[model samples]
Target: MAGHSPADGPGDGPGDNRGDDRGDGPRAACVLCGEPTEYPAEIAGSPLCPRCAWQQAQRSACSG
Candidate 1:
């Protein structure tokens, strides 16, 4: 761990800017809140902010 850290992993690091095997090209904002999304809008099908996603997850969890 002298020259790198765990956060230096593929997706965690900044080396995914070239649309590599991970297929990460350019990211877009959340369609609902206009916040940055982890993946592109197209890939996600619909952009969702973390806050909104968490809320949605909570709702979904409660559905059971």
Candidate 2:
């Protein structure tokens, strides 16, 4: 309960943009599946496309 805050907890609120666009540029590949990706966003040191990012978000929400 100490580490779980309703507002700050994972997937409990709006998505965070702080670490979304940490890449150098656009056009990258998904780190999870290694597929073509644009608007490259760094997630766990891997680039992810919008579609893959959405899927990852959903997964994270469910797991958290």
TM-score (all chains, Cα) for each model: 0.46, 0.40
Off by over 4 Å in 1: 1-26, 41-44
lDDT of each: 0.70, 0.65
Question: Over the stretch 1-64, how does candidate 1's per-residue lDDT look in tens digits?
Answer: 6989665666634555544332555667887888877776457478687888998899999999
Q: Count backbone overlaps in model 1.
A: 0
Give one digit per residue, the lDDT tens place, for model 2 in 1-64: 7787666745522355444443457456777777767655443467777788999899999995
- Over the full model, what C-alpha lDDT does candidate 1 score relative to the true structure? 0.70
Residue pairs with backbone atoms closer than 3 Å in model 1 (clashes):
none
Pairs clashing within candidate 2: none
The C-alpha local distance difference test score for the whole of candidate 2 amounts to 0.65
Candidate 2 lDDT for residue 63 = 100
